[model samples]
Target: MEFSELLEQAGGAGLFQTLLLLTFILPCFMISFHVLLENFSASVPGHRCWTQLLDNGSVVPANITPEALLTISIPPGPNWEPDQCRRFRQPQWQLVDPNATTSSWNEADTEPCVDGWVYDRSTFTSTIVMKWDLVCSSQGLKPLSQSIFMSGILVGSFIWGLLSHRLGRKPMLSWSCLQTAVAGTGTTFAPTLLIYCGLRFVTAFGIAGIFLSALGLMVEWTTTSRRAVTLTVLACSSSAGQAALGGVAFALRDWQTLQLAVSVPFFAIFLISWWLPESARWLIIKGKPDQALQELRKVARINGHKEAKNLTIEVLMSSMEEEVASAKEPQSGLDLFRVPMLRKRSCPALVTSFSLLISLYGLVFDLQSLGRDIFLLQVLFGAMDILGRATTVLLLSFLGRRTILAGFQVMAGLCILANTLVPPDLQTLRVVLAVLGKGCFGISLTCLTIYRAELFPTTVRLVVLFFLPETRGLPLPDTVQDLESQKSTAAQGNRQEAVAVESTWF
Candidate 1:
C-alpha cells in the first residue's frame, strides 16, 4: 500500500489538513505585503527643484503663490511642465507674467538643483524618493534598492531551497518567520538609505524561506484531491492582501508607518507557526518512522478518526517502506541537471519560470506608466490576480496543466504586445488591455508553479514541488524512480473514477 492509502485510513482531507491550509493564509498575506511594498514606499511623486528668493536677502511677498514663484525660478521640461531637476541660475522674473510669451528662458543659464526638492504630498506623505532626495542624479538608487531585495530572494532561494530538504520544512519555516519579522520590523527604523536597503535585503531573504517552507509543508500535508483548490484559496488570500495594501498605503501615506504596519504582524504569525506539524512524508523518508507515526496518529486523532490509536510505527513503516528504502541516499539540486529525464524537464521549467517572472515583474514595476491613481491601480491589479487565479480552480478540474499554461502564456504575450501597438490617445483601451494581459499573466504563473511542482524528486521537491505530488490526487512520490513510474494512486477504492479523471491529464 502507498502512503496515500495509509493517509486515507488516518483521515485524508480531514480537520488537520483543513486547519493547515487555513493557517497558510496569513503568511501568504504577509509575503504579498513585503513583495509589493516598493509600489508605495519608493513611488516618485510630482516634484521640482526647491526655489529660493533672490540673494538680496529680501523675503518674497506672502501674496505671491508658490506656483507663480516656481515659474520664475524653474524652466519648463520638454512637456512644458515645471522642470524637476534644473533651476534658473538667476531668477527670470518675466516668466511669471501671464502675457510673457518669449521662449528666451529656454536658452537662459540653468543648473541642477543646489537645494533639495519640493514634493507634491497630495498622494503620498513621503516615499523613499522624497526621504532620500533620490530624484535627479540619485534616481537610479531607487531601482537599485529593489534590485537588492530581489537579489536577496535569489540568494535565499538557493540557500533555503537546499536546506529545507536536510533541516526539515517546519524548522526552516519557523526560523524564516522570525527572520522576516525581525528584519522587516527593523527596516522601519533605518536612518539611512544604506541601512534601509540592508534591512530590506534581509527581510527578502526570510521571505524566500517562508515561501518555500510554507508552500512545501502545505503541499506535503494535503492529499492530492484537495491540492488544486487549496492552492487556489492560498493564492486568493494573497491577492486579497495585495488589494488591502492599496487601502493601507492610502490611509497611512507615510512610508515608514506603512512598512511598519505590514512587518509587525509577522511576529504573531511566527508564534502561531510553532503549533504546525512537520511534513510526515519528509520524516518517514528521513528514516524517522517513529516521529512519522506519532505525527500520523496526531493527525488521525485531530481528524476524528476512531482508529487513530491503532496507527503504530510498524504500520507507518510498512505503508511507506518503498518510499523510505528509495530515499536511502539524499538527492541534491545537481541531480535535477544530472539525471536524464530530470535534465530535460528542468531546463524548460527553469526557462519558463525565468521568462514569466521577467514579464510579470516588468508589468508590476511599471504600474505608474498607466497614468492612473497608483492606489486604485494597485487594487485593480490585485483584483485581476484574484479573478485569474480563481478561474484556475475550475480550469484545473477539467483542463490539463500544459494546455492551460501554454494558452495563457500566448494570451498574456499577445495582450501585452498588442497593448504597445495601441495609440496613447486611447487611454481606456490601453488600461483595459494592460489589465487583461496582467490577468492572463497571473493565470499562467499559477499554472507554471503547480506544473513545476510535479516534475522532480523529494529532495528538491520540497523546495519547488519537485517529484513529490503529481497533478490532482496522486500520492507524493518519494524518489526519482517513483516519479518516473507514477500512476494514479487516486484509483484506490470507490473514489477511483473521480480521481482517475483528475489525474488523467499531464
Candidate 2:
C-alpha cells in the first residue's frame, strides 16, 4: 500500500488508538533512526573490498579477496621490490557442514565448491579490507544535523509549554503527537541529508512538545498524593522507551524497516487521545470554572464520592483562597536572577537542570558512539533509572529533597572520579563504577525534575521548569574559553610566585 493510504487508514482510527500509538511508537522511530544513522555504512556496497600493493609500495589491484588479511613489514632499503619478500596466504572463507567429518575451509582465491583448492601467496603490502568502520564520519553536516535536532527539542519545549498553558494541554499534546509521527515517517523518504536532518529536527521538536505537555497534563490532573507517583511513572516510561528501542532496533534490523516498525505505534496512539480529559486546574486557570468543576466532579465520582449538586465557584474559590492569594505577579526569564527569593529558588533549580541534562545527554551520546557493549551499559542504566525513580517516589515524602539531591550529586561526582582512576586491568571494576555513576545520576535526575517543579510557584512553575534545560546551553558556549582563561591566569600566577620565591632566595 501507498504511504498516503497508510496514513488515511491510521487517521480513520479513533483518538484513543492514536494517542496510544504516539505515546509508545514514536520513540521507537527516533531511536531506530539514531541507530541506523550510526550503523548504515556497515552494509554499504564496496565497503568490504581489499587493496593490493605493487612492488613500489603503491596500491595495484583494487578488488582483492574480501576475506584476505594482509600484514605489512617495511623493507630495509628503498630499492626493495614486492617479489623480494616472502608472502604467506591464509584461507579467506570457512564452511561448516553437520554431515562432514571435517569442516572444509575455502583457501585464498579458490572457489568454495571446488575440491583441493590451493592458497595463493601475495605480497605483504597487499591489504584486505575487513568490515567497514561503522563510525559516523559525515563530519560537518552530520554533527550539525544532530545539533539542529537538539535545538528543535529546546524550541519545542518552550513553544509547547506556552501552548499547553494557553490553548489547553489535550489539544497541544494530541497535535504534537500527530506532527511527530508525520515528521518521523517523512524522514525515511528524505532525498538529501539536509532534508533528512530537517525532518528529524521537526520530529524531535514534536516529540519534546508532546512529552512536556503530557507530563504537565498528567501532573495537573492527578491528586496531590498521586502526582509524584504519576510523574515518576512517566520518567520510568521514558527509560522503558529507551530500553525498548534497543530491542526494537535489533528486531527491525534494516533502517527503513526499523523506521516503519517504530512509526506504527504513533498511528496507534492517536486513538487514546479521546480518553484524555483537559486538566481541571488548567481549565480553572483559563477561566473555565464550570468545566473545571465538571472535571473535578468526575474525579470525585471516580473516588466513590457523591457529586455534590450544590458545589459552586465560591466554594472552590474558598478552598483555593490561600493559593490564589499567594499567586505572585508574572515574571520574565531574566527576573529569576534579579529577585532575591527567586534567585535562591532558581540557583538550585538551574543546577539540578544542568546536572540532569549533562547526565542524560552525556550517557546518550556515549552509548551512541560506543557500539556492541552499548546494549549492556544501556541495560545497566535503564535498570538503575527505573530503580532510582521508584526509590525517589518512595522517599520523596520522608527525605528532604535538597539532602537527597546533594547526596546523589556527591555520589555521582565520586563515581566519575573513581571511573577515571579505575585500573585498566580491572575491567569488571570499571563497569561497576560506570553502573554506579549512572545509578547515582539517574536518582539525581529524577529528584531534580520533582524538586524543580516544586520550588517555583504555581504561576511560574511550568515556565521555569520548561526553560531550565534551554538556559543550560547559554553557559556552555563560554565554558571552554573561560576554562582556558582561568588556566592561563593560574599558570601566570604560579610563575610570578616562583619568581618571587627565587628573588627572596637571592
Candidate 3:
C-alpha cells in the first residue's frame, strides 16, 4: 500500500493505537541502532575472526619415555619484541592423551586440559594469545567512530531545527528519514574503519534531524491540554529504544551483522514517512489553509468530533495573534535579561537543562562504555526516568513549575552526593544510591523539557530553544535560542503571578 494510506489507517485508528505502534516499533529500531553504535563488537578493532581461532588453539601432544620430559624452547623471531616473547610462555601448558594414559607432571600439565586450549580434527592442540598493542590500537578506532557520530548529532540538531522552521516539519521529517535509511544501509557495507565512521556520522545526522522534526510535528499536532502527555509518551520512545538494544545486541553479536541489523529499521521507518501527514500547525502557518482544514477534519473525524470542518482559518489566526501578543517584546537576545520575569525563568531552566544533561547523558554513556553487566543500572535509571515523567504529568496541575523544578534539582543533588559518599564496601547500598541519583536526575530532566516547551511563545519558540547562550557565557547561534525560549516560558506564568501579587500589595 502507499505510505499515505498506511498513515491514514494508523492515524484513523486512535491516539492510543498510534502511540502504541510508535512506542513499540520506533524503540525497537532505535535500540537496535544504539546497540550497534555503543555495544556492537564489530566496532571494536583487531577483532578479526582469527582472534577467536587463536584463542581456541590447543597444544600438540608428545609421547615421552617414563624418565624423560620433553622441553622445547621456541625462540623469539626477529619480529617478536620482549613483550611479545613473554605471552607465549605465560599461558598454562596442557597435555592431552586420547589413550587415557597416566603421567607424572604438574596439574598444570599431565592432566587432560580442562581449559585454555582447543584440539582440532588434525590432532593438533593450539593456545591462542593476543598481542596487547595490536588489540589496544584496534579498539581505539571504536571511540573515534562514536565521537564522529556524536559530532554529527551536534551539527544536525541545528540544521534540522532550521529546516523544520523554514521548510515545514513534515517535509524535513520525511526527507530526514530517507537520508537515515540510505546512510544507515551504507554503513553495513563499510569495508574499513574510516569508511564505517564516515557513514555512521552521516547516518547520525539524518537520525538526529528525523527525531527533532518528528518530535516538533507531534507536539504541534496535539491540543494544549494533551501536549504534555503526548510529548512525554514520545520521549519515552527513546528509553524504550534503549531497552530494545539489549535484545538487538544479543541477536546481532558480530560487528558487520549488527550494523546491518541496525540499518534495517531505518529502512522500515522510512516507509512510515509515506503514511505520516504534514503537521496541521505548519500547514496553517504556511498559508495552506485548505490542506490544513482537510488535515484538521481528519483529526476531528478520528476524535469523533463534529466540529472538524468548523475549525476555520479565522480561529487559528486569532489563536496565533494571541500567542504573538503574549510573546511580543524587544527582539534582541539581551532583552531576555531586561525583563526580570524572563530573567528569573530563563536562568533556572538553563541551569537545570545543563545540569540534568550532565547527569543523564554522562552516566548513560559511561555505563555503556564500561561494558559491564549494566542491566540493574539500566532498570534503575529507566524506572526513575518513567517515574519522573509520570510525576511531571501529575504534579503539573498542583505544583508550580519553579517549585517542582527546584525540588527536582535538590533531590538530584542529594542523590548525586549520596552516590559519591556511600561506602564502596557496601556494594548494595552503593547501587541503591546510584539508582536514586539516576531517578532524581531523570525527573529533573523531564521537568526541564516540559517546562521549556511551555515557556516560549509559538512564533519564536524554535529560535529561542536552539540559540540560547551556554552557562559558560558562550553564545551559540539561533538553535540554542529555541531551547532557551522554552525555559523562559516554563517559568513565566508563575513569575507573572508573583509580580501581580506584589503590585496589589504594594
Candidate 4:
C-alpha cells in the first residue's frame, strides 16, 4: 500500500484536513499581495521640475501656472513633447514665445533640473517616486529598485524551497511569517532608499518561505478528491488579497501607510502558525512514523472515528518499507531532458508556460488600458480571478484539467482577438472584452500551474518551477523500475490477448 492509500484509510479529506486548509489561507493572501505591491509603491506621479531660481536675493514668483513656467524655463523634447529632464539655463519670460515655431526655441541653452522636481500628490500622497525624486536623471531608480525586489524573490524561492525540505515545513512557515511581519512593516519607517531596498529583500525572503511551506502543506494534507478544490479556494484567496491591496492603496494614498497595512497581517499569521501541522507524509519519509501516526490519530478523532484510539502506529508505518525499498537514486534536472519522450512533451509545455506568464503579467501591469477606475478594475480583475477559480472547481468533476485548460486558453485568445476588432470609440465594449480576456487568462494560469506540476517527473531541478498554490493527485514515478513495471504489465496483457485470439481460431 502507498502512503497516499494509508492516508485515505485514515480519513484524509475530513474535518481535520479542512481545519488544516484554513490555517494556510491567510498565508496564501499575504504572499500573493507581495507580487502586486510594486505597482503602487514605485509608481511615478505627474511631475514637472520646479522652475523657481534665486538671482542673488530676488525671488521668482511662486504662483505661475505650470504651462507658463515650462515655456520660460523648459525646452520641449525632440518630438515637441514636454521634456522630462532639461530646463533653460535662465528663464526666457513667457512673452518671448509669441509664435509656436521660432528660431529662438532651437538655440535655447538648457541644463538638467537643478531645482528638483515637484510631484502632483492628488492620487498618491507619498511613493518612492515622490519621496526620492526618482524622476528626471534618477528615473532609472524606480525600475532598478523594482528589479532588486524581484531578484530577491527569485533567490528566496531557491533558498526557502531547500530549507523547508531540510528544516520541516511548519518551523519554516512560522519563522517566515514572523520575519516578514517585522521586516516588511519595518520598511515603511526606513529613512533611506538603500535601507528600504534591503528590507524589501528580507521581506521577499520570508514571504517566499511562507508561500512555499504553506502551499506544500496544503496540498500534502488534503486527499485527491479535495486537492483541486482547496487549491482553487486558495487561488481565490490570493485574488481577494490583490483586490484588497488595490482598495487599500486607493484609500491610504500614501505608500508607507499601504506598506504597513499589508505587512502587519503576517504577524497575526505568525501567531496562527502554531495551529498548522507539519506534513505527516514527509514525517513518514523521514522515519518518524510514530509522530506521523500521532498526527493521523488526532485527525481520525476529529473526524469522529471511534476506532482512532486503537489505530496503532502500524497503520502509518505499513507503507514506509515499500516506499524506501522502491525509491530510486536521486536524479538531477537535466535527466528529464535526457529522456526523449519527456523532452518532446516538455518543450511545448515550456513555451506555453512562458506565454502564459507574459500574458498574465502584461495584463496586470497595464490594467488601466481598459479605461476604467484602476481601483475598480483591479477589484473586478480580482473578482474575475475568484470567478475563474470557482468555475474551475465546479468543472473539475465534469471535465479533465487538460480539456478545461484548452477551452480556457482558446477563450482567452478569442477574447483578446475580438478586442482588436472593437472600435476605439467603443470604449465600453473594449473594456468588457478585455475583462473577459483577463478572466480567461486567470483561469488558464491557475490550471497551468497545477497541471505542469502533475505533468513533470519530479526531479531536483523541477523544484524551482512551480511555487504558487499546489494540488497533489498523481504521484511521480520514483524509479525507472516503476516505469519498467508499467511496461511489463502492458506486455503481459498483450501476450494474454495473443493467446486468446489463437485459442479462438483453433
Ranked by lDDT, the better of candidates 1 and 4 is: 1
Q: lDDT: which candidate is best?
A: 1
- Residues 1-506 of candidate 1 have per-residue lDDT tens digits of 26666677778878888888889999997798899899899999989887777322367767777677777788888888888999998888787788897576666478898888889999899898999999999999999999999999999999998889887999999999999999999999899999999999999999999999988888777766767777778887888888888889889999999999999988998999999988888898888888888888888989998776777888888877877877776567888888886777777777778878888888878777776577888888889988998888778877777778778988988888998999977877877888898789878877776776666667667442233233454455567776655543433433442352232221
lDDT of each: 0.81, 0.51, 0.51, 0.69
Best by TM-score: 1
Q: How close is candidate 4 to the true structure, as a TM-score?
A: 0.83
- lDDT by residue for model 4 (1-506), tens: 26556666667667877777677778887676777787777766766666664222246566765566667776777666667777777777743456645456544477777877767778788898888889877888877776677678778777887777667788988999999999999999999989998999899889778877887777667665566677777777888887787787788888898899889989999999987667776677666778888777777778776555655667665656655443334544455567654554466676777777666776676654666466777777788877886777666655556677777887988887898898877888887887788788878877775565445432332342222112123443333343344345445554231111011110
lDDT of 2: 0.51
Candidate 2 per-residue lDDT over residues 4-61, each given as its tens digit:
1111222312342234334533443343344323332122211111223323235434
Candidate 4, overall lDDT?
0.69
Worst 10 residues of 1 by lDDT: 497-506
Each prediction's TM-score versus the true structure: 0.92, 0.66, 0.66, 0.83
Instruction: State in Å the error of residue 42, model 3.
Output: 7.2
